[model samples]
Target: MPVEARYALLYSDYEVTPCLRIPFEKFAFLILTLPLCAFIFCIIYSVLFHFESATSTHCHVYNVLPSISAAIGNFSPQREVWQTAIMLQSVPRFYIAVIYLQFHHAMAYPRDAWMGNFAFLLNVTENISLIILSFWTSSRHYTVHEKAFITFILMSEFHMLLTCIMQSRFKRHNRRSLKWKRRLFLTNVSCIILGAYCYMRHNSLCEPYMYSLFAFAEYVVVLTNMAFHTTAYFDFENKDFVLYKYGAAITER
Candidate 1:
């Protein structure tokens, strides 16, 4: 799609998906307001601890920590990282919604050509879980109880990046079938084991060791996932360009 044409979604006459053609008037309002909504979600999420600080006198076992523990829940530098992560997280969800609207259009018009709605759904679910994990790990006690979650996040990161690489490299092939999904599940479980190792050797009692390790592991995970997915996207768009150019609409697995 042309750059102008892609942005023309707010005013264009193209079909929302392969199916139903949508008027810009119908979705323009929602689409126009999404950035605002994402901003709000980030603001609220960033200050969740600050929001709770007024009520946290108990200092439960989960709140042991040295000094930063008292500040983890606030909008400090530590909190800012999650603010960014959670906000970026919304991009995938927004894309998911765009695909969903197209799905609705396709059902209405009966001409949609996008493949693997299930795969798209899986993609959305993974991103949602990822964002949640990011926020949860920001908690002061998250390391104590759920360090394993980071391992799972790393596992998914590698899995999705590899999946994207595979898809991009072999666009004409059917690669992610039953065996692939099983392999993914097994690999993800192993990630949890890596987390266990990290925890057993943990130095969480220190000033910033806890957050440093947590952030380090998560930074690598997010960067790898995002970069691979972004590259795969261009590959996908290019493939779609070719398919559209050649009038090749039907694909079967």
Candidate 2:
């Protein structure tokens, strides 16, 4: 019998519940694609509006890359587009949090289980802080926005570190999984280095060049995160999960 058919036969009394217990790969794909699409749309909109030329002064032509925040903030013509991107990205962020939480719960390793929980906490914190920072633009709530931005960055880095540690543990246990984990670790390191360089050069004397670098670095950061989650597809590809309602009895398959 097929796996699904056999499982169905074993639990004839149970009805399949409609829930978000989707395949890890599918969930990860959505998490990666949605934000990417949103950012691409925001970038195109910003360019079409000539946001930089509109804001440039006598001697200073604003570079669009470093000015992403400014482009999305109150004064920019593409503020609405930026906010829309934020809103769209928030959906994937929420999905990622839930998916990872479920992933960790399902694969509860006795020794390093807490690492997964900690990573999930940081992930949630980063996403919440990002949403808060996006809505409370620096123009109106500068202090609050700055705090949220700093919190988001800190949490994101810590989350990535924890995830790397977790993947390392997996690699030690299952040699077959090492390939993706190795790639993920490299990507994480690259994100950290690029992020540091972007930070150091953000407001330097060569503003335009630094801003462009910052923009590209930020894109790499996002792509690195997408790659990290994409590895989960391989990690959990063969595992099957059956979720039960609260207080309902679960029969082991």
Candidate 3:
């Protein structure tokens, strides 16, 4: 029997009336848009009012734009706004990660399910790391923030790569979602490389706008990461999140 068939059979005894139903695409859109807007707002706020503080580096020179850490981690309204946006999105993202795990398990072979599970673990870890880094600013708790940031980056990259590999193994999966995910993943990798290079050169030579270029690269990395996740919208476009009351089954003689 197929996975869906088995799932239906196992739950046939329960009374499954949806108390709440939400389309995954809309959920995805709201969550992604929140952070994007927050990021932009923080950047603008930093540039407009806190220009010297936002753009100042350890070398006491000003870049064109602030690094994400400086923009959202060091300021007043920016920090609060960023924290709020991330907090709002975090729960939904966790739910989505669980849904993706179930999706992979249902669609993939038994042996391949392990990869899905690992990817799911990575996704959860990445989310947790985001929370840690977001709440613990580098300026305040440098050690915690630095560690969380590193973990978030590592987990995110691995999770995306594994998700793509797992989906590619399925011949009948959504080609459009897979294609776009692969492209976004490549873009993210490119941004990472560019960001690293710019960061290195900035520290070594403190060239004009070098740190700004690194900051811009970091922005692209974030955008691409979010875009890659938004592909989940296509994957689960037709799906609805249904909630059922427990122990509500009825039988008539």
- Which prediction has the highest lDDT against the true structure? 3
Write down the lDDT of every candidate, Cα atoms only. 0.39, 0.61, 0.83
**What TM-score quantifies how close candidate 3 is to the native fold?**
0.90
At residue 17, candidate 2 shows an lDDT of 60
Return the TM-score for each candidate structure: 0.40, 0.70, 0.90
Better of 1 and 3 by lDDT: 3
lDDT of 2 at 239: 43
By TM-score, the candidates rank as 3, 2, 1
Query: What is the per-residue lDDT of model 1 for residues 153-251, given as tens digits with 9 covering 90 to 100?
Result: 654555454443334333253343323434444444454455344434454443324433433343333333443333323222322211222121211
Please report how far candidate 3 places residue 113 from its true position, in Å.
Answer: 1.0
Candidate 2 Cα outliers beyond 4 Å, as residue runs: 1-15, 19-23, 53-66, 74-78, 81-99, 105-108, 171-204, 238-253
Model 1 worst lDDT window (10 residues)? 244-253
- What digit string (tens of lDDT, one per residue) describes model 3 on residues 1-253? 5333322211333565645556657667888999999999999999999999889987766678999999999999999999999999998788677767777877788879899899999999999999999999988999999999999999999999999999998646899999999999989989999999999999999888999999999999999988988998777767554434531111111
Better of 1 and 2 by TM-score: 2
